[model samples]
Every structure is written in structure tokens, then in C-alpha cells.
Target: AAWKAFLNVSQSIIAIAFGAWAYESLGGTHGTPLESNLVAFFGLAVAFFTTNMISVSIFFVIRNKNTFLSVLRQVVGPGGINIVYGLLASPIALIAAFLYDKLYVGGILLIILPIFLIRYSYLSKIQLQQSNQDLLKVLVKTIETRDPYTSGHSLRVSRLARFIALELGLSARRVEMIETAALLHDIGKIDSVYAEIIRKRDRLTDEEHRVIKTHAVKGAELLQSLTSLPEEVIKGVRHHHERYDGKGYPDGLAGKEIPISARIIMLCDSIDAMLSDRPYRAALSVDQVAEEIQRCAGSQFDPDIVAVVLRGETLEKAAAQIREASLPDVVGV
Candidate 1:
């Protein structure tokens, strides 16, 4: 986000610098040279800032296909409104200065700059969040490259997990974190023996299953020191395979002992796995898949989450959502 923001600002930076340079070099047509130059500098700043804000806000709205009103929260709420207001108000300042050469109009905006600075702090927070999300995406994609069969597995799991999270009434922030964790949940397999066996044509032996189980713990340990992710997210990644009845691997947390995020993710993960083809078996039918989830309730899966997921979407519709939202753009992982 920062790099992209910088790219957005680069043209404005040039425009401002070049405007100032030209103002001094070409000399002013009206008012004193110093006065005209200052007006040009401020005018360009307001113009550039407002234009950049509008473009970025529009990009996000189109990219996410969110409601048009969402722009108020995403853009205007984060000081974008101030930028636009200033840009629109700049005309008054410019006109006043045009009629009578004085620093008062520009000075009014100078006073508003401190408020802009405060609003910009909020913008910075959003950018930092976007940057972390982007970095995780890059990491997830890199891991996918290592295990080609799981090409869209992580992404599909993430979208499904996000759906489950929302269904469970988790806060949006929590849902986003869980989604991020889901995308990188299988990252530990990048260097593990399971990477080779993950898509094998034959069933796994006892030892291979055990090795595959180690991935959850390995993934948590891999992320423990990152410090950027929320603790709940890491915990969910670690315990996503844990059963509701305590027979699951790793910590084997049972019932409420399992983190809610983990429980939600577990169901999402299992559903995607069942819907997709495996080396050992073909994908399960929607009815079969629903029955399987029902059969495993309170044992391998959380009964409450299972009930919620089974309420509306069938296995086929869920699979469709995953394909539309999470599939990789190209053939390879």
C-alpha cells in the first residue's frame, strides 16, 4: 500500500516541483514573483492531493465491487473527505488571491494542514493493514508454488473460512485475520515431506499421516516470531484440525476448549477438502458431503458451525463461491 501510495504521489511530487521551478524561472504574470510562486505551489498541492485520493478510493470500490456508499467509510472516513473538501474549497482561496494578492487564503489551508495530518494518521493505519495483507498474499502464493496440487486450496479455504466466520457473527477484523490465517494455513508443508505426498495417487501410510499432522504445529511455530499477526490468528492456524470431541491432533482441545476461530476454520477446511478431488478418492457429492459433515458433528467438526454452514449453502454452491473468489488467476499455483 505504501509503495502504491508513493507511486500515486510521484506524479504530484513532480508537478509541484516543476510548477515551483517554472514559476521562478519563467517569472510571474500577476502579482509579485514570490507571491505567485507560493500560490502555484499550494494550488498544485491541493489539486494533486485531492486527485490522488479520488483515484485510489475509486480503485478500491471497483476492485472489491462493494456498495458505492462504502466509499464513505473506506475513503471519506479516513480523511479523504477532508482532502476533497480542501480541493473544492481551494477555488475560493485561489479566487480571493486572484482578486487581491495576499497570503491569507493559503494561510487558512495552512491552519487546516494540522487537521489533515491527524486524518492522514488514520490513512496510514489503513495502508499498514493493506501492506500486511499483501505481504501475506505473497507468502501464501509462494507456498502454493511449492505444492502445485494445492494450487487453490489455501485460497478456497480462506474464502470459505471467511464465510463461516461471518456466519458465526465474528467481528469484521477477526474475520479478516482468520481469512488471512486460512490462506497461509498449509504453509508448513512447503519444506516438508508431505509436499511430495500431498497429491499422490495412493493413500498415505500411518507415518505419512503423522507427518502431515505435524504441519499445524510447524505452521504455528513458523509464525510465532513474526509478531505482525494477531495471536488468535496464529492459534487458529495451529488448531484448525483439532476435533470438537478431543480426538484431534496437536493440543486436542475439545468442545469450547477449541478457539472459536479454529472451530469455524475446521469446518470450512473439511468442506473444501471433501469437495475437491484427492489422490485417493474422487470429490464427494453435495448430499454426501452434507451428510458427512452431519455425521462428524461434535466429533471431527464443531456441531454449531456445521449446523450454520449446512443451513443455506450446499456443497456445490460453497464450491462455486470458492472458485469465484479464491481460485488462482492462472493454471499453476
Candidate 2:
């Protein structure tokens, strides 16, 4: 916390210095005409905002030991809302400063309400996004409670899917969509109808297995009821079971017919399943899991995505992370 505060203060100081240098260098004298000073004012604002963002971004990169682009994504917020807020606030701040210079305390008081309103609006939007995610997590937790054997399954899949999506060089928006879809992929199992099947220790009979297959479409329908989920997310949950060769399930979306998010989740879901111990089988080693994924490519999994997973250390890194944090130990261990 202290280090963050220090960085913030440093950022402010650097921005202020840059703004002052820009204002003076742009030739704004004490009695300059409003038209002439406008250029200098704009220059000062640009310098301040740019300097501030750069300083803060640098601090985040060093502090987190992450890449600049990743830090930039965090600072900009999803969809660049934070950047929009900063742009909106910049002009307001300049207007406030001008008013204060002209009318002293009265000018300051006049713009105070507007400043607060803008700040409040930005915060409200952020809070609303966070609340929505929390609601999704609560729903996931409910599903977890319904079947203890699959504890942390969704989270592990989500984490692995995120890593795979990143490895595939997907855009930030696509990554978020894939991660969210993976997290809710099994949400349909939350329904009481699947309680017995999910909790059953023995092998499922054909009838019970058929019932379980409905979960993909069921999850999509349940999420569709929310009305706010994106179409990609709905398709991901609906088609995750679909095989690449079109032999899999609920609609049998073949090849690229399945959404990219669904394809990523399908592979990740299977990976986690192999890594986790079930009543019927022990968890497979990482090498064994990789071999299975390779064996299934172009049939059960997307060949392209499987290639990405096998490239470099992506699969190993993803598996290591999930085993260490996102998933429970193998049942006996």
C-alpha cells in the first residue's frame, strides 16, 4: 500500500511538472488572449494526462513483473472506460481551474458538484461490473455446493482456458469472453434435476448419461434467461460438448461451427477432468494428459487450438498453475 501511494505521488509530481513545462513552452503569458492561451491549455492537459498514464503504467509493470501491454490493459479498464473517464475529467478539471482563477472560492464551489458527479458516475459503473461478476461467482459456488466431488472444477477450467486463450494470441475482449464462458460452462448442473447424476459414485447408465448430456444446452438456456449474457458466452456453454468431428452432443456443432470460446473451454474442461481424480479413475499425469489431448485433436478437439496448447510451454504452465492454486488435490492425496 505504501509503495503504491509513493508511486501515485510520484506520478502526480511528474505530471504536474510536465504540464507546467508544456504550458510555458507553448507561450501562454499572464495576459494572453483566450484564443492564444487555449492552445497552451490543451498542450498542458495532454502532457499531464500522457505523463500520468505513462508513469503509472511503468510502476504497474515493474511492481507486478508483467508486460507493458498487460499493465496497459489493467490501467485502461475493460473497453477503455477508464481512459474515457480520464478524458472526460480532464476538460472538467481545466474548466474548474479557470473558474477558480477568475472567481476564487465561488468558482471552486461552482464546479465542485460537477467534479463529484463525474467521479461518482465512473465509480458506479465499475461497481456495477464487479457486482455482476460477483453474482456469477455466487451462482458457481452454488453449483459447487451441489456436488462436492467436483469442487473447484469450474475455476480450474476457467484458469486453464484463460491461459490457452492467451497462448492463442486472442484479443483482450475474446480472452475475457472465453474465461467467463469457461467459468459458467457447467452452470446448468446447478439445476436439481442433475443432482443425483452429478453425485453418483458409480458409472452412469446410458439413460443417466443421456440426461447429463443435456447440461450444455440447459446451461445455455439458463444463462439466456439472464438477458445480459453475450451471444458468444451462450454458444460457449451450449456447444462445449460438441466434438470437432461433429459427433459430440447437443447440436453437434462441427469444426469451426462451434464458437471459439466453446472450443477453448472444451479442451480445457477435458484437461482438468484428466487431472482431477474421479470416483471411477485416478488423475492422469501431465504428460499423459498432453498425450490424450494430442490423440484427440482433429476429432474431439480443435486441431489448431491443440497445436497452440502443445507449442512452447503453454500446456505445462497452465497445468502447473491449476494444480497449484485453482484445483483441489487428487481425491486420495
Candidate 3:
């Protein structure tokens, strides 16, 4: 944290210095035309914004031990609203300068309140996003905690889904949504009503099976009521159980009728389940999983997705990742 703080202060200082230089170099202090002043102010804002983005991106790359491009994608990618807010806030300094020139001390004082308010609001937004993410982690943990047999299940599925999405040449935004959906795909199992059904060792009765099928819809409803998540994510959770041939689940969605995210997640979910050991069956080999998928294609699973899984080391890669990340079951925890 202290290192991060130092980096933050350093980046701000560097950005401010660059902005000041650009402003002065553009004849900001002299009797300049209105057009020139506008140019100078925007130049200053751009200088500050660019420098700050670079410095912060570098810090994130180093701190997270991730690649620079990954950091860039997060800042400029699909859900980078915070970065947009920062860009919008960059112009506020120019506004402050303009006010100061017009009304001197009074103008400066007048702008101070708004400046603080904007800063406060931005901070609050950051805090809220952080809190929401923390809450999501807790929920994922709780979901796994409820059913001991599936410890670390959601996380593995999420990773596998991300890999599959990337392999399928999906956009980064779509991949992110798919990963999130996979992580929360089984959230319905966390419902109080699912407690006994989830923990039951024996095979489910016809009634129990029917009740279990409602989980996909229930999970979607839970996300809708509790989160401001995207509609795609909700639909992904809702339709994950639908069969490609229209024979499965609460929605029997067939082929292209199913959302792509749901399609990808449904396959990934099955892959994880097939690979994991359950009371009724031991974990299957990667080859066996591939064979099962191949056999079920066009009926239970999306044939196109099944093809992707069977293609050139794709299933191997996904299975290797899950195996590498295997954790102890949370049976008693």
C-alpha cells in the first residue's frame, strides 16, 4: 500500500509538472487569443491525462505482475468507466483556471467547492466499485461454501470459460462477460431451498431433478435483483442448462436460439463437472471428456462449441489449467 501510495503521488506530481510546462509553452500567461488559450488548456489537460494514464498503467503492470497490454485493456477496455471519468475530470483544472482569470480570488473560492465535490464523488464511485467487487468475491465463496463437493468449482469454470472465449476469437468485453457468467452460473445452488438437494449423496428423484433444473432461472433472477450486472450476464446464467437440440432444462433453448455466452458457459460448466470427482463418479480423463463432448454434440452440447473443444489442444489446455489449479474439497469447512 505504501508503495502504491508513493506511485500515486509520483504520477500526480509528474503529470502536473508536464501539464504546467505545456500550458506555459503555449503562451498561457501572455496576452493570448481565446483560441490559443483554449488550445493551451486542452493541451495541458491532454498532457496531464496521458502522463497519468501511462504512469498508472506502468504501476499496475509492475504491481500486479501482469503484462502492460493487460493493464491497458482493463483501463481502456469494455468496463473502463473509471478511466472515462478521469478523462472527463481532466478538464476541470482548465475550468478552474478560467474562473480564476475572470474573478480572481472569489472565482477561485467559488470553483473550490465544485472541485471538491467532483473529487469526492469520484472517490465515492471508486469505493463503491471496490466494495461491490469485494462483495462478489464473498458471494462466490459463500456459494462454494454451501456445497462442499464443489469447492473452487466456480473459479475453475470461470478460468476455463475465459480461455475458451479467447480461443474462439471473441471480443475482450464478451470474454469478460462470459467469465463472470461462468463464475456465477451456479449461484442458484446457494439458495436455501437447494441446501439438501445440493448435498444429497444419492441420485436425484424425478421431482428433485425438476427442482434442480430451476437453478439456472433462479440464478438469473438472483443476479437481476441483487446486482446491476449486464443483461447478457443474467441471460448467460439463466440459459446455461438449455440443450443445443432443445431437450434440456427450464428453457429448452436450441442451437443459435441460445445466447452465445450461455452456449460457451454451458460447455465450460460441463467440462468442469466432467473433470471433477463427485460421489457418484470419479473424475474423467481429458480424452474421456473430449469423447463425451464429441458423442453429445448436436444433442446435449452446441456442436460448434464441441468442435472447438475437440480441436487442436484446446481441451487439453483447459483441462491442464483446471488440474493445475485443483484444490482440496471444502467438505467440512
Candidate 4:
């Protein structure tokens, strides 16, 4: 979020300069401190907020994770909410400006107070998001330590899932949850009980396979209390192994019976698995992977999601990007 912070700082400077200019135009330093400062404060706040909106738009545009309309909605939704408070406080600013000749340092304090609050709160929010991301990275590193060959699996799944979700026309909020679930879908495998099963090079026995299937449930439970994630997120982590047909474990949820987030994870998880090598097998050919997904649709996978990756214009591009960027999964620790 260095970019975000930089934009905020730059916007603040521009706003302050604009405010000072506005104050000078109204009446120079000869006027009372309160009125002049209030005018400056109002000018700065509006300008800062306006420019901040622009920066947010540009920031997301450059990132280009979603369509222009999607990014616009994502940026404008939060900004519109924040702007309400600014509008409400406008009257106070007007009053302060009117009483400029009458007041002193108190008005200046009032003027700076809102700016300080806005900046502090915005920075704090950014820091919190960064911390969560760092935490996810740590978890990914832990997974890598367990299976070096599978390094970057979770991140790839997350990236692919997010793009697919956005392509499906889901709202930004739903897409975010899907991305989070994708990143943590394999969390249950981190349990010590699964160590031997996970590292085994040979075929797993029926009991070992059964034990392995429990990882989905275990992962969801492990994360349930740790974060205030929605039920969709937890369910997605738990039911990612579920099939479109009724054959999946933990829950036999079929078709629409499965949460959309879980359905997304299932498809994404499979794509990553096909692209990634395993201890037992090398990565499949791209053509083979595509054929398998198409063949498995309506049975092993969601036909809709499969169609998106295989046939939809938007998702096809995203899937291609992931293929080009994804790291190959090598065998051996």
C-alpha cells in the first residue's frame, strides 16, 4: 500500500495548497484566523477527498484485476460512504468560516482535527489489510516448508479464483471472500496427523485417503475462531473437495447445493492441481487439462465454472495469464 500512502500524502499537500490559495483569494492574512483557517480547512478537505477518489480509481485501474466497471463500483462504493460524513461536517466548516473574525486557535484546532482523524483512520485500515496479507503469506510459507514442490499453490489458486469470480460478474465483496477461501483451502493439510500422508510418494491406502479427506473439515475448523470471516468463506474452505455430482466427501453437496464460493474453489483447486506436478505424477499437458475439465463438467466440477474458463472470453484471458505466470510444481523436498 505504499502507492496508496503516497497518493494520500500527495493529495493532502495539494489540498493544503488549494486551501491556502482559496483563503488568500477570499481575504489575506489581515482577516481573523478562525474565518481564514475555516475557509482553508473546507477547501483542503474537499480537495483532498476529491483527489483521493481519483487516486483510488487510478490505483485500481493500474492493478487491472477487474473490468473498468467493476473497479469503478469498488472504488466509488467506499468513497461514497466516506463522503457522507464530510458532507455532514460541511455545515460546521461553513459556520467556522463565517465566525473567522471572531475565533482564534480553537477554530484551527477544529479544522485540523478532522484531517488528522481521516488520515490516521485511513492509514490504520491500510496497515490492518497489509497485516492480514502478511499473515496469509506466512501461512503459505509454512505450506511451502511442508511440501516445497507445492510452493505457490495457494497463491495461484487465489489469483485464479479471484479472476474467475470477477469474470462471473459477482460483486467485489463476494469475489474477495472467494479469493480468501482459495488462499486457505488447503489449511487442514498443515495438521501434524496428515504429515506422512501428505509426504508419501506411493499410492495411499484407503484409510490414508480417508484420513486425508478430513483435512477440509479440519482446515475450516482451524480457521473458524481465528478470524471473523463469513460462513461462505469457512464453508468454501471445508467443501472445496466436494464434487458437482454427489460423490464428494465431508458433505455430498451437489450442484447448487454447494456454496458458490466452494464451487469456485473446487474448480480453481483442480486447475492448480492439474497444472502442478505431484510426487506421483508430472503436470498434465495443457490440452489434457482442458479436456479433463470439459469432460468432468457436470460431474466432478461445476459446468458453469468450467464453461467460464474454457469458453468465456474474460476468464479465458485470465486463465491464460495464470498459466503464463504460475510456477511449475517440482517433486522432492
lDDT of 4 by residue, 15-83 (tens): 567656765665546444554465555555666555555666666766764455555555545446555
Which residue pairs in candidate 4 collide?
35-100
By summed lDDT, which 10 consecutive residues of candidate 4 come out lowest?
312-321
Candidate 3: residue 190 lDDT (0-100): 79
Off by over 4 Å in 2: 15-34, 45-47, 50-67, 70-85, 162-177, 244-246, 291-299, 302-333
Model 4 spans > 4 angstroms off: 1-66, 76-108, 311-333
Ranking by TM-score: 2, 4, 3, 1
lDDT of 3 at 49: 75
Return whichever of 2 and 3 wins on TM-score. Answer: 2
User: Of the pair 2 and 4, which is ahead by TM-score?
Assistant: 2
Clashes (backbone N, CA, C under 3 Å), per candidate, total 0, 0, 0, 1
Q: For model 1, where is the 10-residue window of minimal lDDT?
A: 70-79
Candidate 2 TM-score to native: 0.77
State the lDDT of candidate 2 residue by residue for 118-192, as single tens digits.
899999998997899889988898888866657778987887788777656565677888999999999999888
Scored by TM-score, the top model is 2
lDDT, residue 159, model 1: 80
Cα lDDT, all candidates = 0.72, 0.82, 0.80, 0.76
Please give the range of 10 consecutive residues that has the lowest summed lDDT in model 2: 64-73
The candidate scoring highest on lDDT is 2
